[model samples]
Target: MPQVNLLPLPLIASTRAASNAIPGRRLRRFPGLYRWLLPAALLALWQAATSQHWIAAQVLPSPYEVWLTLDYLATSGDLWLNTAASVQRVVAGFAIGSLIGLVLGGAMGLSPTLRAYLQPSFNALVQIPVLGWFPFALLIFGIGEPLKYALIAHAALVPVTLGTMQAFRQAPQPLIEVARVNGFGRRQIISAVVLPAAVPVLFSAFRLAFTKAWLSLVVVELIASSEGLGYLIVYGRQLFQLDLVMASVVVVGAIGWLIDRGFTLAEGRLLRHRLTPGARP
Candidate 1:
């Protein structure tokens, strides 16, 4: 047999060219940040417009005023306390809702009979606007923590269930056959093949569910409950405190941003191997 060369000249040249073409290794790895630059510019423009009173400061409190409000709230420990309470409630409700979504989704995904049985009702329920559930949730759970959980669960269930079921149904047939040829049992096939294959799609579902839970928390608070970021907005409205309302809006937007950031981190960690450039989330 002829001896083979371990290092091919062309391969070496290609690797060097790729490395040199990239701006930097770190920058290449984080192209996601580049897209956020536009949003950052928009924020600066908005801050300038508001701060200079280009618009009525009453209608749009300057970012500085909001920051000052935040600082005051922070010094009094009021911001932390209220934020902590809201966080706990939203997190708890989201966890339970996500769990339920995963279970029900798995059940339908794996079973044609179950899917047939549940599909119509599931589709119907999902079509109802989530905010419309507030009155019913209140009637059922009565202005308590249960209402929060119920409403969030309602918001989270659809995207997760649909994404999971659709992902599994669309799993590559060849991959399933490979698992079968290896003599894997149903559970083994699901654990080894289906879950890994479905994960990237499920990550998208998770992102949707988290957003739903966040918004649902606010809605429930505004309508029924006594506390949370939503309540902060409602309280401001009732008192005609536009600055408070504007401040709370900024806080809500900030919380949403942090939550999305957490998801991006989690996706990078969880789907490290499968994530590819330019793939749909």
Candidate 2:
């Protein structure tokens, strides 16, 4: 027998349509189109402020002037040189920090005794801000690449360690039991079940670590380095070239955005298998 249609036809059809809609797909496909709106508005506001003299030209150069400075820096190779130095520092420091963090965090996660022994000291140390370590770092490493590397690595270590420990600890007990029931060894269970579950969290940790390392590199450069993006900013300020300072800032932000986007893409690819069937790419 045919089922009675109790609901209104319009409501039933609308519900069906809504259920089948793929909003996330649209968002993924047109990300730039949507994401550029805020930046565009800000640019407009900046231009308006400059034209209206609401901000002094000496303090906040026009966008066109900043663009010209950026072009000059790029053409003269200054921008690339400074940027490359900063990138190299970030890579070296982040790699070392992340490796150490993973080892310590994994050990702590797998053993309650180690966690109890280390966590208190770790928490206490991490409470000290990055700048607070500058004096000690200077005494130990001096005003050189070693100082930059030490500081950047220290900035990265905290987030990665915390994220790794929490991720492993929070892994589903049901999954672990299932693995054990299947005769899996500790290593096998960790490799197949625990790591996969922790991938998303670890990736988030990497993002945070990378950002911190990048910022720390800049701060270290500002304090002691003769070259790098941070130096360019300080140089501009010393010479009263606000446009140059702004240009360096713009480059820094763009590079950071690109790095973040790269990590996001990697996370999506690495975790694709864990996504729901209808999840966006």
Candidate 3:
């Protein structure tokens, strides 16, 4: 240290700028490479673990083995059919629950009368676990599709309703006043003012409800079903087909991820619409 000559902040900024410039120039060439890189690395790691026999191969099959089983399922068309069934059930449950939740929640949040009559019972019922409802669901609808739908719907609706109610209740007072001053009727106020303000929260509730519905479908299928992906896992477990089990697990995870991604995309589009030039009051 002949001399303490610190690089000036401007020079540090210039260096960073120069370094980033090269990557910026190369960005077009590497578009989307990072997207698949993480998954590939994970697959590689799993393959390495299986090769090293860190856990018994029979217990935790290699990535390739799982893929092969997946391929078999795919080729036979069973995977698509089963996946479609599970997806439909999730959609059905989410749709029904979200619709009812929005109406009930909006009423409860907006009017004191509705809240007084409904909130107590709804709050208490939410405490009951999804598993606990299975027995009653089975008794009500039997071991049929309706039973699963009923269970999934109940599991999903509570959170959605609660979230919607809270979100609507907390809409800015100034905005509400503005809506009324603009001669908006009660229906118009809710449609134009309250709903827009609460959209983000409502969508969040939808996402939660969808996740709950998906989980409920799996549980329902596992407990009382002849088909579906969860049934596939149950079958694999019973038959001691670890590869099949792992493959089915991977499928379930992938499907759930895809559903979430779809919802996120929809949320983004909806938000974009709400943010346009003249959307708000």
Candidate 4:
């Protein structure tokens, strides 16, 4: 099949030049260091405020107190248990949601008739926030694991579906015409041209979906769960243990940062390959 380069030569040359530049490496490293400045400042402020009693213990515990609480939870294994539960829910729901989204979105992209039939309803349904579905899901699933899964799945599904549809729809018409001129069939064209072109956008969609799923998982656990990081927060609040609440919040943030970093690395590798000259099929 004939392959067309949608990007101009000058753009490709510039990209290659930027990638090899010493300034680009410095620019990347600078951001990693620069991004920590604010967080460090915030931590310092937090510590000072608590140490000086500017904030009450009931309002916000000292950083040392939060650290002790985190250590205690870790030693007791409750932290690991709750963290695992939350991660498991997000992974399961995200997988199910993204799979279904890919199928539905692909079909819609391939068939205008199917898109016409489904797009309106999907848009209307997806407008409802995860919390808006909480009461309805609770009614149907009755505060069980299924309730949490349903909400998280819905959260993941909306973004992935929209992204997949857009990615497929945005495939260059010239490329499609070129594929057809080369006697490529529908499946061949999709596999050889469309999928490769859509990789970057699809990765972005997956990242967004995972974020939504993770957030929805926490919210669901907060409202309905007996155990999970969110439940740990609720439990801490009920007992007026601000330190435990802070510890759980810290764990949540840390996990989110780690997962986002993982996504970034994965995206960087895939995009590096995709952006390489003569890489596309």
Candidates in order, TM-scores: namely 0.79, 0.85, 0.85, 0.87
Question: Which model is ahead, 1 or 4, in terms of TM-score?
Answer: 4
Better of 3 and 4 by lDDT: 4
Question: Per-residue alpha-carbon lDDT of model 1 for 85-142, expressed as tens digits?
Answer: 7888778877887788888888888999999999889988788887788777778888
Candidate 2 residue 83 C-alpha distance from true site, Å: 0.4
Model 3 gets an lDDT of 0.88
Q: Which stretches of candidate 4 lie over 4 Å from their true place?
A: 1-31, 278-281
Across 1-281, the per-residue lDDT of candidate 2 in tens digits comes to: 99998999999999888777767667778877778889999999999999999999999999999999999998999999999999999999999899999998888888899999999999999999889999998999988898888889999999999999999998889999999999999999899888888889998999999999988888888888888999999999999999999999999899999999998898888687567786532
lDDT of 3 by residue, 1-281 (tens): 49875999899999989998987777768987777889999888888889998878878899888889999999999899999898888788878888888888988999989899999999898899888988877788988888878888887898789999999998888988998998989998888788878988988898889988898889889888889999999999999998988889899999889888989999998888878988653
Candidate 3, residue 155: the lDDT equals 73
lDDT of each: 0.82, 0.91, 0.88, 0.90
Ordered from best to worst lDDT, the candidate numbers read 2, 4, 3, 1
Model 3 stretches with alpha carbons more than 4 Å out: 1-38, 279-281
Indicate the residue-level lDDT of 229 in model 1. Answer: 80
- Superposed by TM-score, candidate 2 places the C-alpha of residue 156 at a distance from the truth, in angstroms, of 0.8
For candidate 4, write residues 1-281 as lDDT tens digits. 99998999999999889878967788677867768889999999999999999998899999999999999999999999999999999999999899999998888877899999999999999998999988888899887888888889999998889989998998888999999999999999999888888888889999999988988888888888899999999999999888988999999989988988999999999888877898753
Cα RMSD for candidates in order = 9.9, 7.0, 3.3, 11.7
